[model samples]
Target: MFIDEVKIYVKGGDGGDGCVSFRRERFIPRGGPNGGDGGNGGDVIIRANKKIDTLLDITSKVKFIAEDGGKGQNRNKNGKNGRDLVINVPKGTLIKDLKSGRIIKDLKENDEAIIIARGGRRGRGNAYFKSPTNQTPRFAEEGRNGRDRWLSLELKLIADVGIIGLPNAGKSTFLSRISSARPKIADYPFTTLQPQLGIVDLENYKRLVFADIPGLIEGAHSGSGLGNTFLKHIERTRVVVHLIDISAADLLETYNLVRNELALFSSKLSKKSEIVAINKSDILDTETSQIIAEELSKKISKPVHLVSAVSGNNVKDLIKAAADLINKESEEDLLRLSLPDDYDAISNKGLTF
Candidate 1:
């Protein structure tokens, strides 16, 4: 199961208690306080693992608690510290505080880790209270309590390009054809209920991650169909590949409907860099495919590519074009970040939807 969101309770380990003992030997004269300090508690940590794609494992186990520290021995031996508990999640997982509803960590890169709960401090032994004036001191500090909190985990897929369109628009097919990801393909709508990621390899071993999002309907923005469940996965993408079926009636109207849904969902999404693709060209003749592609290009005022995922026609060009656009956008972003104030104004041109 592909679970994106989950709520869990985590707690750190408690500190160990201090030891109080009096050494009694055969010939020893004055045996002062022979006490040892307690050991520190264990912490709760969350780590990002690239191999994980969902929060399914975490959901199975709701409550997570670290081990408690061992108590001090009678011979003035310090207690052992408890081991930390590490939870692994996907690379794009976001950890939020349940009480405050604030984002604590956005794990975007692999191997990134954050300490969710801190361990308690160890208690002091009675020997620490020994003074010159007071010969026999018997006071010892108690161990502190560990930290505990309720956390919410949400996973947003991180991909360079997101494949978006209506149900059965060949988004999954395109991903399977270009990359090694094999998503379930059927002739019905809503075939893909979850987001699927695939790595597309180009010439010279160049590669890009592509995500196939679930289909969007007319009321998708308003909690209709799959609604905004998978929309968040596409928010981090650099580019969106809008795939439209060429065999559908009134292709331009279908394109506009999808665009309107995107705008309603998020202004940022509608303004993101987009590449139009008319899929299923193999089902249509040359004249029909060209007409549909030309009309869509004119309607959207952007370049449109006619390609068939089944026949593998123009798919390579489409992939290359998408990669090139992503690279150019990255370069532009870098330039904007590095340039001075005067050059910043020129690079701040508003996005064209």
Candidate 2:
């Protein structure tokens, strides 16, 4: 199952207690304090794993705690340090403090890690209190407590190109034709329940990652349809492939609706490099297809591409164009730019089925 968001409680390990002892030997006439200091505690860390595409693994376990350090022993032997707890999540997972709603870290690259909770400091032994004026001091400090907090984890699929449009716009069909990702395709709307990733390999060994997000409808920004729930998944994409059904009566209206929903969801999303694609050209005649493409191009004031996902006509050219745009955008950062307002609130509400 694909899970994009989850909430968990994490805690660091506690420090070990110090030891109090005195040196006692037959040869030594005077014995001083032989106590040892306590060991430090372990830390709680979150790491990014490229192999993981969802947060399903982490949601199974709600609580995570690191191991505590061992206590100090006699003969000036320090205690052993606690083992660190590492939690693996997807590459685009974002961690935030649940209470304050502050972003702690954004794990964009593989192997990137952040320490969410810090361990406590070790206590000092009685020997530390011994001095020239005070002999055989019997005071020892206690170990400090570890840090604990509630954290929220949100996953945004990182892809080169994002395919978006209204329901039944042939986004999934186009993705299936180009790559190996097999998403549920049907005549009905919202066939795709989750975000699907596919790797399209082009000539000259060039490759592009395509992400298919669920379809959108009016009021999508306010959670009207599946589009609002899954829209955040495309926030990290470099370019957007706006797929529109050419056979629809009001093509321009549908296109504008999708664009307006995107703008309402995120201004950055609306401003991203977009390639308008007129899908389902196989059903329409040559003249009808050209008319619709031309009309939509003029309405949007951008170059509109004519392609048929079912018949694979002009699909390669569209993929190449998207790949070129993705290549140019890939030179920059792939992570989503930080939004002015905290988006953690939206993630906490959870996605509806």
After TM-score superposition, the amount by which residue 334's alpha carbon in candidate 1 deviates from its true location, in angstroms, is 7.7
- 23-140, model 1: which lDDT tens digit per residue? 6677977788777778888899999987777788887799988877766655578788889999998888888999999989888778999989887788777776679996666766
Candidate 1: deviation at residue 155, Å? 1.0
Q: Which stretches of candidate 1 lie over 4 Å from their true place?
A: 331-353
Give the worst 10-residue stretch by lDDT in candidate 2: 344-353
TM-score of 2: 0.91
Cα-based TM-score, every candidate: 0.91, 0.91
